[model samples]
Target: MTAYDPIELKRIRWRSRRGLLELDLVLERFFAQRFDSLSPAEIDAYKRILDLPDTDFLDVVNGKADLDDPEEAAIIEILRAV
Candidate 1:
């Protein structure tokens, strides 16, 4: 499996800290639980989603909306549980 470079993981972790508290908390939990095991595909999917506005990102994570790609959708499903 492809591994995230340490710098890349750091960048992702930092970005995951959203302006929205609820989203931030959920993302923190997600990282705590799953960061180590994440597939490179899942990491890339998350990077795409992270480009959304904080509110929009929260909506996606909270399942009130969806992403277009199947990889993104799969990651979002995993996110919902966290």
Candidate 2:
């Protein structure tokens, strides 16, 4: 149960859209732990995005949203990667 740095989380938030860094980190950790058998930080970010409207989410990624939200940017980044 290695502890993840909250400051790193903050930096991730500051540098990325809302919780993108945290979400990416969490997903990476989850897969690493489950498939690689590595103990990593718990990921709880997907829960937030799961409920967001598709248009709002797409708008954020497309840079058409006016909310100036970071989480949207993060979603775009992830979506593009996949």
Candidate 3:
């Protein structure tokens, strides 16, 4: 498991808060349930994903869109699985 500083984790949690309620719920649940166990690469992927446009992010979470980037896709898969 990759250990994150509390500040970084706080920032991540903040970013996970999306404009859409469904996205927020899904991401918050994933953050709470999986963030602590993420590998460094996965954590990075999660951060990158947080930068995605809200619509794209929602589509990814809902399995309505596909990310061409493998790392992003992997992170989305993990989020959806959780």
The candidate maximizing TM-score is: 1
Which candidate, 2 or 3, would have the higher lDDT against the true structure?
A: 3
Superposition TM-score, candidate 1 onto the true structure: 0.91
The candidate that wins on lDDT is 1
1-82 in candidate 2: lDDT tens per residue?
Answer: 3455556544434432334544455445434444132223222233344345655544544556533345534544554344
lDDT of 1 by residue, 1-82 (tens): 3567779988999988888899888888888887678888889988898899999888888778988899989888888987
- Score every model by TM-score: 0.91, 0.32, 0.88
Candidate 2: misplaced stretches above 4 Å? 1-43, 66-75
Query: Which prediction has more favorable lDDT, 1 or 3?
Result: 1
* Clashing residue pairs, backbone N/CA/C < 3 A, model 2: 17-70, 17-71, 18-70, 18-71
Q: Tell me the tens digit of each residue's lDDT in model 3 across 35-81.
A: 78888778888899889999988988899988888988998898889
- Candidate 3 vs. true structure, TM-score: 0.88
